[model samples]
Target chain A: MRLRLLCCGAALLLLAACSSTPDESLYSDGSGQLGGPPGPISPDGTIGSADLNGGQPAPGTQEDLELTVGDRVFFDYDSTVLSPVATETLDRQGAWLKQFGSIVITVEGHTDERGTREYNLALGDRRATAVKNYLVALNIAPERILTISYGEERPADPGNDETAWSNNRRAVTVVTTVN
Target chain B: MTLPRSPRARWLPALAWLAACLVLPRAAGAVVELDITEGVVEPVPIAITEFHGQTPAEQKFGRDLADVVTADLARSGLFRPLDRRAFIQSPAELIDLPRFADWRQINAEALVTGVITGGEGGTELAVEFRLWDVFAGNQMRGQRLSGTPDQWRRIAHKIADTIYARLTGEKGYFDSRIVYVAETGPTTDRVKRLAIMDQDGANHEFLTDGGDLVLTPRFHPDGNSLGFMVFRQPVPQVYKYDLLTGREARLGDFGGMTFAPRFSPDGRWLAMSQAENGNSDVYLLDLDSGRKRRLTDHPAIDTSAAFAPDGERLVFNSDRAGSPQLYTMRPDGGDVQRISFNGGNYGSPTWSPRGDLIAFTKITGGVFHIGVMKTDGSDERLLTESQLDEAPTFAPNGRVILFTRKDYRDNHIRLYTVDIAGGQVQELPTPLDASDPDWSPLRP
Candidate 1:
């Protein structure tokens, strides 16, 4: 007990010299961009101030593609089979891609958060490939289209309701580059 | 009957201490033998006093070390640490002779006390701790660890490991690491980077820059490298991240998208799911020779393959039987047998280190559950049920499972751990929302 009190006295005297910050580098690399994308989306789905043009068809722009051609196609639960609505949307997308032959497009397939992540990833890959296959069948060059699966990582709606899940289970066609 | 020896025979430090017991005077009572076979239905009450230190730096480190040790023991749910305020004996008193009556008054069955010395100037740090069986009035285990001051936390973990092993008669998992995907932002544009930390969620560091999305960070059997899927270029490919040098290298050059990479138990080969022509199949890549071997040729999806501890067989999930189910086959992909006969789908089959049960995710009627079953899939037991709970990784001891639980109501995902014997489920604290956690092998 006396030794304990003596040690406490020493600790008090050494407290001033013992002030040292924890090694921050051990917890973080300091290079990580620790948050999500900036700029909030408007109610109409346009991000930030990009909607000032009143949804006008500005040529060769992301907004223009959304205006001229639909950028997404929805899928049913656990099914990669294209619906009539999806096919019709892809038909227009195929025609748009042919008109802009220099544009390279990526089909990102997504799934609801119900399944396992890896299986959802594989399902998303199939969904995106199904869309790409339809576009290729519509006379669009196969080399112009690429496919990636976001699995359930990227969702259109963060809610857990059926409506949010249905909205999340869709294939989005994004223009990668316009040559 | 003789006690079962650990397969690895890595308990030399404890054995050496026991050897010293032969020359010391025996206590009046027999050493307390704790039978942990029933698996901690009631946590053993333990008391850990603040360690004594010669200097201020040593004093602060001693307190922090005891805190970590207490947290580690408490996290396992096998030991409940008594509050420091209830302590009757001080550290100095405990060092010479713990007042057994005082400890028994607090109902502490076990007690831990330690001292830290040196580490003043250029001298190395020395930490010595003793585990006492309070009721037995005997020292159960004692050991001294010497390392640099920066490794104080690791020494504390070693102390925890020693105490846990002595009581449970099984290896402890305190001295381990976890690699998981750190998640941020909204659901749509979530930024994920491969991050690693101590098993207790300290000393975290992100391995990736978050420029590209990373998923399913799996540790190699050697524990020096990681295998994960990265969305680079237009396709998702498997990449290897070396923990020692922080070098990233793509695993294979395939015409298809590859994901869900897992290392073989021997760390010689990598198994992953590759998708071509809209169909995904399991493939193995030989790491040394860079040769590819197709493991499954079914039309349905075959992925999330894990090797048995012996490295002779594999357990994977396949949809070939109409819906996804767990299947086991030879390492060469022959003699396939479906093991999951339940109505729901079973995915993400991770073979336990004990080589007895396979842990998996079962989705039935839209609710996800983490479960384990026999190797032949006979005795199935679901351990947890939630709106979304998947990706179960076993502790090195194979007694506890760490998994991700998603609260759909709040869309918040966090890591949770539960003992296989089904007690209280504990949520592991992390700096950010995390998922796809893979526990590393026991530290060397």
Candidate 2:
């Protein structure tokens, strides 16, 4: 047990060191053209102002997003139809994919442990494909997408309850890199 | 009666007189207690001397019969065949005037000697086997079986079964076949088909094509038909695949998901769990009339139902009590009682063929284990602990189980058998990745 704690602590330290890098700066050229500084303000100039925090805007930096698990998608029992809320969440994910334009994402599908082995495998595939097709319809490249189904093998929540089942029947989006 | 001895005869006569005195029913019977906790896993010492023939046809059958017996005993994992190169005496010498000292020196605890005779239609095998207790210096059991040359392998298997039962006090797993699902391809597009192989994992043939996904193939009471779930169309339903006629008829549709089907001991009813809407429940279908009976009515999921050998009750998995624990109920869904409360979750409850206990998969501390408990859920003992273990199926003799063990991320599953007391774990070799193993009922 102590070894587990030590390993977790070391992992947290590594994440902290990795996340401390400074961001890059993006300034306005007073004409909506991104350049060094502002030119003389015209009469019809509408400068909404730059980000006041003065934090660095790192080049090629996509949105630092952590895809939360359960809130993304929900599946009916043994069926892989995407719920309405799931479609809305995937729309936001599709926007992320469009705005970033660089990162490739992997969508992993899982299921609850209440069905046959082969059925669950097919169900997991359908769930992942539902999400992948949504992303493709949102103008995301089908070439940048890769999917894998774990069936009921890997559970996001290990409890054998409705809460766990709802969380386990999900499709996860994992950001790999900046293109 | 004592044999007439020419030279050294005094002590032999006296010993015979003493044996008569003990058999006269005058003395009291003695009670003995022995602690036999330890025994060697070494193969039983056996010597199969080649049989000889007096006629030409006799010569042809005798040699072949002896070879069959040798192969049978060697493949049983319970006996060792003394190499023919180490034979000190010829077959004729040993059959007529047997020298016990020569066999003892070669570490043979038992020796099988035989001869062949001509019959009207086929060659008759006059086979005799003598099981000697080399350590105790006495003969244990001896018998002779007469069969034709065409029935030679049956005679050999019978000998192996007798020898194995005598030594281990348990029925042998030979003369059996294993039916399992063969898997290939990636997890998404996995091609799963029902396949059957010999008990030693040989002569594997596909029972169904991989065009459709098959899951959890179980043997019927007669061992010729398999109860499984197949997704041929968009619907997932249960069906029985007959080995003789190559016919597969749907086991009646339950509207939603229906899977994890198994046959009762009498082959009259099948217990399966079907999902309606989002809720899953257990149901029993009469094989003859296709009449369906609802067994469990709960909002929570219940599945993996197995019938006790007696067919009056069943053990199944349920999440009604908040987690997936085992529960037993009557065939009519009465007398429902919770049987497991030890830990994280349990699924796949398979009643032992002996009708005493049920084996299941227990998940605790993030590791899956194969565990067994009595009918009332007492005396829970975990047999094997691994990263992921599931699908515990018992051998027909109720002495061992064949379950899949998966480690690392490779998913190379191998079948393993362990004693009922969780000892003597041996891995059954298979050519490919196998899972959902079902041992056939004992051969008729």
lDDT top scorer: 1
> Which regions in candidate 1 have their CA more than 4 angstroms from the true location?
A1-65, A95-104, A177-179, B1-31
lDDT of 1 at A138: 95
lDDT score, candidate 2, position B221: 89
Task: Provide the RMSD of all predictions against the true structure, rounded to 1 decimal.
Answer: 16.8, 16.7
Model 1 scores a TM of: 0.84
lDDT of 2 by residue, B225-298 (tens): 88998865445688998765567888886666577798989999999877654456889999999998999998
Candidate 2 residues lying further than 4 Å off, grouped into runs, are A1-179, B1-98, B106-108, B111-130, B135-155
Model 2: CAPRI class? incorrect
Per-residue lDDT tens digits for candidate 1, residues A1-179, read 99877755554443322233333322211212111222223566422234333323345655545545567787887779898767867887887887788998889999998889998888898899999999999999988888888889899887888878888888888889888
Please give, for residues B1-444, the per-residue lDDT of candidate 1 as tens digits: 111112122222221122123123536674455566774567789999999887898888789999999999988888899999999898777668788999999999999998888767646677778888888888877777766565677778888988888888888999788999999988889999989888998888888889999999999997878999998885679999888767899987888899989999999999899999778999889999989899999878899999999998899988887788999999899999999998998888999998999999999998899999999999898999999999999998888999999887777889999998877779998888999999999876
